[model samples]
Target: MISSNTAQPMKDIYLPEPADVLKASPMTALEMFFEFRLASGRELGHMPGQFVEVSIPGIGEAPISISSSPTQKGSFQMVVRKVGNVSGAMHALSAGRQVGIRGPFGTHFPVDGEMKGKDILFICGGIGLVPVRSAINYVLDHRDDYGHVTILFGTKTPADRLFTDEMQRWASAKDVTFMETVDRGDDAWKGNVGVITTLIPKVRLDPARTVAVVCGPPIMYKFVILELDKVGLKADRMYVSLERHMKCGVGKCGHCQVNGLYACQDGAVFKYSDIASVREAI
Candidate 1:
């Protein structure tokens, strides 16, 4: 047998594509919207709820969801919250800056398939809106394909609200029923003041035909699920984006493992019935 001098080629799982920051705009005190385009001329081609690992040379990398819909071609966008070392460094970069993007990784929202022609309900808490916005925009962009759409968004305070401009557009649109709430009220807030769960009760939908998508903090899930159930929504009908410390974005790190499932591989988005037995999932 000939001695093999050649080693098997390793997949570039961690290698990143050069991306230029086309624009960056501050959405709130801690969060900002960043737009990027690949220098290699390839599109990110990401679906709703899918994420990419943003890598900064010598700084580090972090998993962030694509906030822009695939329908918007030529580029992709991510809403970054300046919560860590990588993110804080990312925030410091201005437009025309360069960074590395590892993937449009993990599972994506089943928007084009199962969600077609069905009434859609979006329940987002604070930064949860980032990923869910992709689905919301896809539905809005393809309005004829889906049924009634409703959006319920909640934030910690009025000042913490993200995408105010987009919210205004959705609120005024005839296609979607929009409601916003805050956990606490301020002197300036004019809309509802309560947990996001409270907003779900006011809306009406046929549970059989409606698919609910939710993303938020740990405590938010149980309460939201409880309220959705009261309206005849079942676990199987609900899809959620589970937040985890997904490092590899490819299930290699095992950091985002929830029982037998890995959030980075099996999902960041999972049907409620699928993960009902996963104690750590909720």
Candidate 2:
């Protein structure tokens, strides 16, 4: 027998750790913000642009992106949209409620690596802002490590906006540029009114030194890429999140596979150039 005594037991990837809901609040009519702390009292230690699998005992499980940066220690945060069984169950939860958490799985943005010392342009649309917020806050926290920062956000209407207070803070930052837009304007709306792409042309950046991070609905990708191109952002210099395609937090299930790559395994975040040839990726 080949060193059977020295063999280690395989770890179960599907096993979930118990976590407590420290807080839950409404961000919009459809989304709820949740803060969770592991029962073991350790940090989630998730990277920006990564995700976790949230499980409710009887309702099933769902993959939710981590909305808080790792710099925010002790607990982690998620913005869950009440669109399905698990998320709907999560919205009904309150502080003290317990849930299961599987991972801080998948690849993340290059905040500490290639992105350092480079200008960053963040483009977020609708609920897509949830995942991108992690990276955004990380960049803001270490503002000195990066170059100029520009953040652009768009939603269907003013009523659909999330993190309003944070957006205002970002706008007020001395070195940051923040702009928001809506598809349609209302009586209460006083800002730009158009798709997110329209805001792209208004900003000035040195494309050679700038890296763009984009996340949004599937339909938004095609149009936004065109806009980024017009602004001279190269495909290799851009990254995008495809969190919507993630089903199983692990790659065992084929649900999240885009061509031959698994979104949950290979990435929910990918360099635009890496997946440009993968037909189903975008």
Candidate 3:
């Protein structure tokens, strides 16, 4: 329904359009980043947090988040963690390979709506940073539009981190406060050590006008929500992305159902107030 991307919108939700792989960079042993330019030669016109269904002609299809912002024109980015057959096939792609794309599906972070004029607190653990980074960078690109911003990142170990170069820039910047820690540290490590939730209480922010966006592993959600509440953030002020078994991204199937709602149709990005009633939604 949203079309900031100038490229052609999907003519058929079940039929995928061609998108070429311009580059593929390894982020970790299992995760890799791919930059795509639609065969239509149009921008993906995707919003932060929206996902696209990537199809490998003979292999199959998988849904991946748009890691880059529409603010960065021309193309979009996706970081895929290879945990199955489809993702493994994606990891095998090179610079010139072509893949099928179906969407910029589901709801997204409200970059132009509730997010405007508000301070932002981002909590990302491990691969969860993929979508969180999209919102963070959009706020950074238009720095003057928002108030104070804070970023907290957690990794399993010192060696498992992603985007080391950009991480350093965020750490050193005066405008944005960035904090990081690892679950376990080695002899070479000297920094905060513990769960991601440990870093949440130390930072102070104005919860009245702040929006906390969180994404990571499923288990991390409830604890993060508990911590955000401790900091005085109201239930409605917190937004979370729920991962589900996605099949029909357009809601025709009920694969990603939470409560009476379909995650694909109703939301994958929901206000805590909207989904708190569902015990499994966190």
Per-residue lDDT for 1-282 in model 2, tens only? 677687788989889999999999998999999999999998998999999999999998899999999999999999999999999999999999999999988999999887999999999999999999999999999999999999999999999999999998999997999999999999999999999999999999999999999999999998999999998989999999986556678888788988898999888999999999999988
Which 10 residues in a row give candidate 2 its minimum summed lDDT? 242-251
lDDT of 3 by residue, 1-282 (tens): 967889866576689899999999899987899999999998888888888888988888777888887789888999999997789999999999899998888898887888889988889989889977788888888888888889999999988788888888877876788998999998998999999999999888898999989889999999999999998999888888888877768888778888788777677788888888887687
Which of candidates 1 and 2 reaches a greater lDDT?
2
Question: In model 2, what is the error at residue 55, expressed in angstroms?
Answer: 0.2
**Scored by Cα lDDT, where does model 1 land?**
0.92
Q: Model 3, 280: alpha-carbon shift in Å?
A: 2.5
lDDT of 1 by residue, 159-229 (tens): 99998999999999887899999999899889899999999989989999999999998889999999999
Evaluated at residue 146, the lDDT of candidate 3 is 84
Candidate with best lDDT: 2
Model 3 segments beyond 4 Å from truth? 1-10
Query: What TM-score goes with each of the models?
Result: 0.96, 0.97, 0.94
